[model samples]
Target: MGFKAALSKVFAWYVNRHLNTVRQNAVALQQKTFSNLIHDAKNTAFGTDHHFDKINSYEDFKKHVPVRDYEELRPYIERVVNGEADVMWPGKPAYLAKTSGTTSGVKYIPISKESMPEHIKAARNALLSYIHETGKADFVDGKMIFLQGSPVLAEKHGVQTGRLSGIVAHHVPGYLQKNRLPSYQTNCIDDWEEKVDAIVKETATQDLRLISGIPPWCQMYFDRLSVVSGGKKIKDIFPNFKLYVHGGVNYEPYRARMEESIGFKIDSIETYPASEGFIAFQDSQKEKGLLLMVDAGIFYEFIPSDEYFNDNPTRINLKDVELGKNYALIMNTNAGLWGYSLGDTVKFVSKNPYKIVVSGRIKHYISAFGEHVIGEEVEQALMGVAAEEGVEVIEFTVAPQVAPTTGELPYHEWFVEFGKEPKDPAAFALKVDKALQQKNIYYFDLIEGNILQPLIVRSLKKDTFINYMRSQGKLGGQNKVPRLSNDRKIADELKEFIV
Candidate 1:
């Protein structure tokens, strides 16, 4: 066998052996993880305050530590930012990952030295699992273009801080760094437009085999590569291109356009990593959901979505979760975040292997008129229409049209950027409305009762999202168009670029 194939065989064997053990002992592993976490942090102020010394089991841990969102933990994080040691963890965190906030301002999530190893290990395990499942690792011997955020970090209170992708860029393995495209100089450029240009120029002639990024920005890069190489698809430019490592956002909406840009199909591995921690990754090709990272330095809890907004919600650990329930994720991690709400909702698809599909952000849904529509429902409805119409949705955002000043009744306004223009716009909108009505009983009831008007689909002009992102100065790297909003803030702004 060739060198690449031989290497892949060996790597695959190792990954499978380890993963088998994990799958077989998922429950036991989670229990052990919780025990270890409690032991590790027993001396920290947070642990001591919660009586970690007396906590002996999952029930004890939950009873002592109530669920807390970012706002609740902000004060402790602020103290950490001000250079306090052992305030949260054993010592001050080495780095902070700055995540953009919707309700609150910026969130500086701690990345303790102890947590960094787990972060790196989880990411590697994700790739290794993919290789083990697919047996396609020839790309390892070729170049990879990780279209990440700028690696230039700024200091806050003597602690390094930047975007999560930027933080990860600093720790790219030495061997992979050699194979990674877009020179460090290019990656360090702060301007998105200039950095993309530099990346396109530097890697146009290289032996690229793998590309990794959030799909929207990667679509932009692929489009640029096509333009720079005389309208050639990515496959033509790099015949060895094989895999796509995507995370941070749902890949469904961007899939069609991204494949068109590449002019061929490629295997994709989805990952679930937030500023809080690396939570899960796709470990099986047979499944759609990501396998929960039971062994990672994070203990997980779940509060049902229905109960989450209640005055006092019920919290359940891994052993208590049932398949198919929508739950808001709570995590206590090695980085010293205890009972922290990650703000994302997920539904378990498998119990044996503990896999979940991210449903939506807790705050990013349209609930006007009491018809709650989440990200997963919106994505499915839109993609359904696209499938039936044989068109592709490039990007989209939805907002409630509550209390219109004009005589028109209230409804949901959809601003869609299309990769392939539909043959009939009116029909497309009708089909989308029908699909949504099918998925959400409350939305259907509202429509039937005439309490809510039909959904409106506005065709946004090409590059409308790009222009919008540029206006907000978040055109690249982990930033995305928020799928749903409560007010007309996004709708009014996006209307300026309607086709």
Candidate 2:
């Protein structure tokens, strides 16, 4: 090996050894911490102050306290919003991480001072694990760009209470903070459009080696980068760039677009980030899926995705989880969310507890017409059909819509964006239909001799779907194109421009 390569390898070895040791220690420490916390919570819930009141098991905890969604906690958050001392947790919330749900307009999730370190530690371990895996720690310790959300925290009495990103920025290591774009606090202001514009202008000339964010935002930013740089390849803008870190949604649709925009095959690191905590992240080597931060200040429970929210959901403890089964994740975090189901599903790819693939979201499934099609199944069908027909699908979405046929029922419609038009649209559609039928028998029953017809591949101009999302006030930030819809409304909304 060359000198630099050899040094990189040695450095990776050292880092990995250190990480393994630290992870083992952290896991032990976290287990003890979580055990005590669970006990305290159980005691507190039942009006006791003793630290060890023995609420040890999941069943015991569940029996005493019912599951709660965000709405139930809104009042406590409102107390913080009104500048109360000790709103939810013991101390005043350090910052609020803004997130949105389908029904909730905007939620300001409290970020406590005690839980901040856990987030930082999980993030740090993710980055360090990636570095060790890739043996790329020697690459100038290059600039890490975070394509983050609007940095604005809600104001109480005209004073800015920091957002999570802002708080994190303040605590960033001096070395890393100097290289971050837009600074942390400045980015937290609610005006994301202006912030994105500033980010594009300022970083147009910098040598960014790493970029991390939701896929849609990154794609949009790179598109703007292309225009600002007068059609320069994204690589040209940051020639030393080595990796792109993305998560928050299924990335298959955006992968080709991102590669085409960047003009290179860049390494990607996917993560499972949520307002509750940073759950897991891709290792530096880009091998396998992300490694769950088992040592982070959280205890995990996996309920089978199919059985989630059932009258009696069966949950697998951390030790009993198996490989290759999809499970809805339930987390008990140091941030005060106990037995909270974050609504995302994952499947383990390895027996080692840390490695798993984010299968899809619980809410992103389509079963409107008795066809229970999931995100992974749809992606697989699309990929399979594309492979068989030798076509490249840039982006796609499937929606169950009521087709006004002469004495017929509604069917599922697929809106697809391809690099170019296919030779035989009908044959391509048939292949996808059969694939879906064979891959998922429930879908077959729904389509056989029923109103639900074969899959429709409404090929559109490149970036058409993304443009539609941008037009809908759901792009360029945390918003993304929904992969699967229960009805055809969203697909119909985007159809006018396809032809």
lDDT of 1 by residue, 11-40 (tens): 778877988898888889888989888998
lDDT of 1 at 111: 95
Off by over 4 Å in 2: 1-15, 18-33, 39-54, 72-88, 156-167, 183-197, 284-286, 387-390, 403-406, 449-451, 460-467
What is the overall TM-score of model 2 with all chains considered together? 0.86
Best by TM-score: 1
Per-candidate clash tally: 0, 6
Cα misplacement distance, residue 155 of candidate 1 (Å): 2.5
- Residue 181 lDDT (model 1): 80
CA lDDT of each prediction against the hidden true structure: 0.88, 0.70
